[model samples]
Target chain A: MTATDTAARMLDRGVTPERYARGWHCAGLADAFRDGKPHAIETFGAKLVVFQAANGEFGVLDGYCRHMGGDLTQGEVKGDELACPFHDWRWGTDGRCKQIPYARRVPLRARTQRYETVVRNGQLLFWHDPEGSPADHDLLPPELPGVGTDEYTEWFWETVPIKGSHCRELIDNVVDMAHFYYVHFAFPTSFRNVFEGTRATQFMESKGRPDKAADAGGYGDADMVLTSEATYYGPAYMINWLEVDYKGFVTEVVLINCHLPTGPDSFTLQYGITVKKPEGLDDKTAQYIAKKYAEMFGTGFLQDVHIWQNKAPVQNPLLCEEDGPVYQLRRWYEQFYVDVADIAPDMVARFEFEVDTTKANEFWHEEVAENLRRRDAASEADAPLEGAGH
Target chain B: MASFVPTSEETLADQRLYTAGWLTSVSCQDCLAVVGVQKNSAHHTSIQWSAEALAACPEMGRRPRELHAGCPRLQASIEQAVRAGQVPIGAGDGF
Candidate 1:
């Protein structure tokens, strides 16, 4: 069948439902580990926790218990299951009760809610797409080298409350290139050129802030690529990718962001700083790495958070003709945010993800040098054109 | 922002209301009148409300007289001249 026909069929009501701005989203909950060790992940107005069984297998569960809505995280972690602290009602990853201390035996109806979950590409993937249909595939970044390594890496995570929707801010930040220069004024250049690689791809940069009073061209190459696409996972969340080639410059440098739901008016940001361990790395290496990422990339994000938080607490509007990926992202998000046939309450999980933030801040120094070199070249070419052979 | 209102042809006899991410609209037999709203407000500020509340809604105020806060009585009062509509709501600027 043609794509249009398939698309229409995919969108037909009663076939699947879309809730939230996108049907389902991945928040990079945890890299590894489980034994009823609950990891809570919030995104797009939803809260979920994943309990890791001692046997390395696990189950997805609603973060809140049906009985008194007590947090299941603090409960006892048995062999490959969990026992609710309030009433000692035990459950497995499938959300079914394994035993009931207060009952004669396990009741047939004693089951904690569960959701359809799949572990893919080193991350746990869940359906947040409105239809919660299988047709909506898993969303993952292209596999890069050293994705899940404990040798040169260590990870820690902190979930911060952000008062705003994740899609608008995420889509905005992923496609925004100009902001890198202006918004991040801590760097040398205030403006940077663009090298468009295609409709939705841009690589490298051209010119930026030029320094006239100083020695110029003392910089090295610093490059990044921006790619955007719409995925089956959701319509609103643009499937975006950014690849930065730092070429042995910094001690530790990374950029990462994932969204989760905290409240209807807010979401949480989960990031990992992929830091290559330094020679004398201390035990608090994760903290050092996170500090660098927060200092560099996180500040700029903080500014964006301010803007997003202050915006109307509803779906932000955009015109496809103006906003590059807004059209597809909006279409994708509608299925999750507006459609109801896709709502699933059992999708919640306790998220505890790995974040290696150990790399040094050498990249900013390189960036400054690169900006200086460009300025020097432009000035040399622009200055005293030898009276143009009059 | 668009200065939009249901075409005069629209009448309650024709249609009903629906909501989107930030938009809520009353669709009649002829046209659709839409207003942007914070979706979370539904937990407390529902489709049911007073005329003053309807007049305070974004885009709903453009024709405050037409927005009934989903209350038939409010609409009936304004339609039958029992109540007088006031200034528009949510424009962030005095009209």
Candidate 2:
């Protein structure tokens, strides 16, 4: 297409609004907030304070106090309330003013915006709705299958602040079947997408390329087959059940990829991983595997970050058959952007798209062979002269 | 598997309103079992198979579930169907 045609197409697609999606956004690891101290968070273009009560209940409220606008997160946690540092005014988890140190009675209307909080899969998530609607608990991400059990290690969480991109860029990866080969270095054998209601799922079975994997920190071997079923519970949270089988040494990993918008053009991306402990393995070894797997996963995400940092937002993407259902996935994602009344039937309607990977597999196999040939040639050139070294 | 069954224009128009608008039913040339197929591009073909179709497939029935990536016979049939314009590719063409 001509530049003018491209510009016109982009104009027709329009710009993504500077708005945070309405759903449960993760704050951080739940363990970080259970220290009986209020933790300050910046998200959704607003400040929030996450605190835990003595009884282990978590509370999320506006970071500023009602009276004099004091930063509540800097204050101390007293029982089930968070005491404002500026005036020592104690506020209950319900957002009601409980006590004023010098006043005879606290004002009945003295309250701040309290967010609905849910702790699932060991992450603290707060509900956000631009329309101020109450959270539907049913819409929250379900509990991970192997988490919190003896079979899995504790969650290893990492948060990175992504700049110059909207969070939707990350969400678009759900339907991008081709990205696995080009971006993540996996040759997808079969790829499918299912979008229904508030959930969008991607099912993929892929074989790893050794050359590409080595460049991305040697995470995968050529013989490995990675099968993953990843689902987005809402706009931000995605739970991926990934199984990597390398010559029968199988590892099942639960990867949580979630993010919260910090600004119109930026977001804080957070991902947590928990590896299932193999039978007869020691706890120390299991813990080590979990940490290494998390780092390897982090490296994979960094690759995407590099692209998102420089890429422009494309609303009407020119897609191929192997591209999966990008438009359909975006339509499903629009449900979170609109009010309940404005949501279209197609947005929630069930749509399934599966890419026949027969051709892709053949093409990727050839590519991998070509890549390996180049790598071997380079390695041979770089090798020290065998007799000269002796 | 290389032979394509010519579909009428009326049937192609009717396919646009199917639940999966981009997909059209193509029968396996060997087994004669129908499976929904869509070729989004030259390199991408999507096939949706029903249980009855899978059961009727001579090749798929012999293979274990885990080993079944796709039936080669059906894949060849789908490719031929796409080449003959029996399957629609590109956005909004079928829908």
Candidate 3:
């Protein structure tokens, strides 16, 4: 190919840089920032400071002090304000200078940018708008079920910093049904996608491969079925309500998967899981089970990470019939990257797609059976020879 | 059969039954308690035991309900049944 042709091809396949999505992105677990200490978060090409007041209120402000560009996170928290490490200038949660220990008077214009933040389901989420628009608290995600109740275990959180891939790659999984089998060892029986204004949902019912299911402890029953209804509130936060039905009993699990763009091509993906205490189980056993489930679920996300780390961004993907609505999902996701006034009507229009899993199920069933047969044969081959030691 | 009735939409009656619908009951060699058993694959095994079966197994009867794992005698009996073609692997049609 000519140099011009090769350059054009690269451009066609490469993901172009775009502005960060405007929505509430989770910074981390709420408890991580409630120790009366300020934590620094790097995202959107800027640094932010997250701190909690003595009266149990959370605050997020620009990391640098407006007075002398001092790192506030490296400073101390004095009462309800964060003090700068350089000159000990105390700034309130509202980003206004409260006291300057060395100055006679605080300047009227001595202030920094403060972000709107909320704690939902044990997650700390801060609003991010590219155009500097104020956040609407009414648009926040609803409270997750069984979050603070005694019936559910505490949230188990995990974060993976992924590099060299746009956050869109993760969003594409909302419509990609075929990856469940190949990547996650799940045989999806039914799958559906719904996209509306600022929200996209994926409803899936699946059966795990016997070998993979065995690793999930009590969920190893032959008749176990997994159902998940995962919905993205806006661009970054997704809440998945999962149910694992094991013939005689059922387990309810909630998974929160959220991300924030650290750069134009890199993002930090985080996921937390909480499991309802099974009936007749001790609290210790329930906690153990929840931890195991979190590890298993984390493995599934890492599988996606492996593929994303090695693959190139595809602008025009060659998709088949059962690929779900990738184009429609991208259209819906585009609304967040652009200014509110420039958003197209189609970006917020409702679109629904239901994938027919009959063909995929047929193929997956055979593949799973073949895999099981191979495993059994290999086990027999590896078995000790009869009377070998004798 | 279990007398517990599922109340919520999350619980399905069909999913309560064993995937291997044709498997016969296998009696524990030590406890002599019969229970329905099915082996879907090398890794998945489902056992349906009743109150009477639980009471009959001395090992299970001595332990608390929460501490009860699978009875070793019953597992051995099921493994023998699989080897004898009495409980076939991958015989169910359910996913």
Give the TM-score of each candidate. 0.50, 0.80, 0.74
Output the better candidate (1/2) by lDDT: 2
Query: Using TM-score as the measure, which candidate wins?
Result: 2
- Model 2: CA > 4 A from native: A1-13, A218-220, A381-390, B1-95
Which residue runs of candidate 1 sit more than 4 Å off their true CA positions?
A1-18, A21-24, A27-36, A39-47, A67-69, A117-125, A129-142, A150-152, A155-158, A164-166, A185-254, A275-294, A313-325, A338-390, B1-95
Model 3: per-residue Cα lDDT over A119-162, one tens digit each: 98888898988788888787698897678689899999998999
Fraction of true contacts kept, per model?
0.00, 0.09, 0.00
Instruction: For residue A311, give model 3's deviation from the true position in Å.
Output: 0.7
Cα distance off (Å), candidate 3, residue A108: 1.8
RMSD of 3: 17.9
DockQ, candidate 3, comes to: 0.01
Each candidate structure's count of clashing pairs: 50, 0, 0
Model 3 TM-score relative to the real fold: 0.74
lDDT of 2 by residue, A1-390 (tens): 334322543222245565678898899898999889999998988899999987778889999998999998899999888999999999888788989989999998998899988888888988999889998898999887769888899999999999999888899999787787777777778887766678888888887666665455423446668899998988999999899786787899999999988887799999999999988899999998888778878987998999999887665465445557766677678788887788877677555576767777888888878977887887886642222110
lDDT of 1: 0.40
Q: Is candidate 2 or candidate 3 better by lDDT?
A: 2
Clashing residue pairs found in predicted model 2: none
Candidate 2 versus the native: TM-score? 0.80
